[model samples]
Target: MTKPTLIFLILFSLNFASISALSQKPKALVLPIRQDVGTNLLVADIYGRTPLKPVGFVVDLTTRHLWVNCETNYKSSTLTQPKCKSAQCQKAGTKYCHTCPIAARPFCHANTCGYYLENPVTHQNTVGELAEDVIAFSSTNGFNPGPLVQIRDFLFTCSPSALVELKLPKGVQGVAGLAHAPIAVQNVLASKLGLKPIFTMCIPSGNSNGVIFFGSDGPYSLLPGLDFSKTLKYTPLTISPFDEYYINVKGIKINQKPVPGLNISLLSVKDTGSGGGTTINTLLPYTILEGSIFKAITSFFAQQLSKVPTVKPIAPFGLCYESKYFSSTLLGPGVPSIDLELEGKDAVWSIFGLNSMVEAHPGVLCLAFVNGGNEYRAKVNIGVYQIKDVPLKFDLSKSVLGFGGPLSGARTHCENFNFTTVA
Candidate 1:
């Protein structure tokens, strides 16, 4: 080869190698969440807090900031309290500077930003110093995890252990806030990495790990290379002033028939923000509906399944029946499907038997729903149990919710996601 030809070949080889490396870099951050059956809480694996310790955090959808227990021998070289006037403090919406009456420690620092962190499980509030630390997550190509990506100064509150003493699941140290707040881990990661503010969650119903992806839609590639994104149905997502997610659900249906006596006006939000509406909540285990809505739904459901022998009602469950009477389908129990009539043409979120009914006891199946009482603000509160096994994408940038309705329609489930580490 001539000198010029050899030089051209060398440059081409270098460029090709660089492109190959870039292509292999993960396009999204992935977090594996395990379902704690006893507590009905979804716990996510997080590696952080100086020296990088692996900790489990309950996934809280309504929490504004990530709060962790730092009162017990918490030591991190990268932990630093933000000044009251710092940008970090402003982002957290706290203005008061904290004062420590006792000795200053990690969360009890003086002249630092004071933030009120809530225990998602107990709903108890405590004041803690707003601080930053190094948090890391595994990067993924939307299929398998690649390597660890670090966020050098992730913002969180160093809370006391009292908030979690008896409330949270065992081995879980903190709450990972995935709400629509600016300081939420998902948004911070997206902003820092220059990616779109979007996230997708597929909660597993079984013992296996579920998957959550930040910044990409899919090639979700559960076993058999199925992409749940293809089945997604789009609907406008409304974020309340309180940072809760609400959908434009106009009505409800059972077995393709609309429930009678459902006050259409009761399904809407009022001007005072205290009237009836539907909102999604991960903290809640079962779907809760207003008293009237609940009565109408259960009455109609029981009527539809008249062939099944009724049994004495369970304490929490209003209706119960012999489980043997019901047949099994790939979707779930062979029961009537419930549909949420949303805004737009043909936008209905169908909830199959798996998402609608729960086996409260052996040989006994009950509707996995609760009456929110007449005073409940939201007419419909969609909980995590009803959302599991469905691929849900929250596009904060576009204010849209893309729901890949029940995967059973495609003969797959959320637990099918491969968790094996990629080399």
Candidate 2:
């Protein structure tokens, strides 16, 4: 989406309450965010009393935990143990799953009080002391960059264990939680800088090229230039079953026919791990839908593939056939948009056939969804694969998410679209 004609103004010297409109700036420190092997990460160097090395910090919206690499290279003179006296210490006492007890041991032991989180997948431990550090977003552009933002005394766990990733190129040094929790990186920054508690990001497909902005007000309410308010859709954030950002999914329909039993309710999503709001995660490689929804979607696929000669089935991915007919199957294939009914009949999020398929091998693509087995409550995981190239903005202040695309034919610099208040 292109920026509108209105202007965004930033008053650096003004108090948080004062920077209401005009984009509330000293201009948002726009930074580049890239996808590294399914993980959305940014470069965030951690520096203590003595400077430590700066490295890539993965941004995870699903969980609220701040962690830094506990590599041996981190030997700063100022690393201090977290004091049990403060509430911050209680939260960072240990890895989230460890369930560190509330007693004295929870916050401190052997004069070392910080945190320890074991990698659930790797079973390795990341141990560190709760300490303060600096968080900065490395600039992507060669020029027209804003001043470096280094938030000092930033509280986080400094674990020494290497992040265990099944895939390599091992670019992540730590994780900065952006899940809107009390201790999240974004929340801490908003509170400290007195800026709006909101951020917007566009994850570009393929290239590690993407951008992020921080603000609370809507783009339309702020500046006309590069405003999303035009096509931006709104839905109330779902709060129960999990505190993560979720919109009420009223129904799922294909060819305008609503599928029964596919919904977002406390009972339906209680076990979905559906990062569908929690328990369900968006970063997963494939989308997992409730069995009923899965059946509905696949039924449509069967009709479309009838005359087309497709390749054989692939593992994990639900469908695969000869790719020779791929291009034909996608074009005018009578495949209708999969509409996600949200809030009211007027609100619909459409997922076309191209959006639901993933290329698996040479000249072949497959359906990237599965029946989220009985283990999960009825939930839907909006995997990254389905959202690539989509421009979305999460208004932390409003708890509303807006996404735009038919996959713009021309590249839209939505992330680079920032405004400065008139001098």
Q: What TM-score fits each model? A: 0.91, 0.73
Candidate 2 has an lDDT of: 0.52
lDDT of 2 at 376: 48
TM-score of 1: 0.91
Candidate 1: tens digits of C-alpha lDDT, residues 61-111: 788878888888678898998987999998888998988877665468778
* lDDT to native, each model: 0.79, 0.52
Return the number of clashes found in candidate 2.
27
RMSD of 1: 8.4
Candidate 2 lDDT over 354-380, as tens digits, reads 566666787766777877755444366
Per-residue lDDT value at 358 in model 1: 88
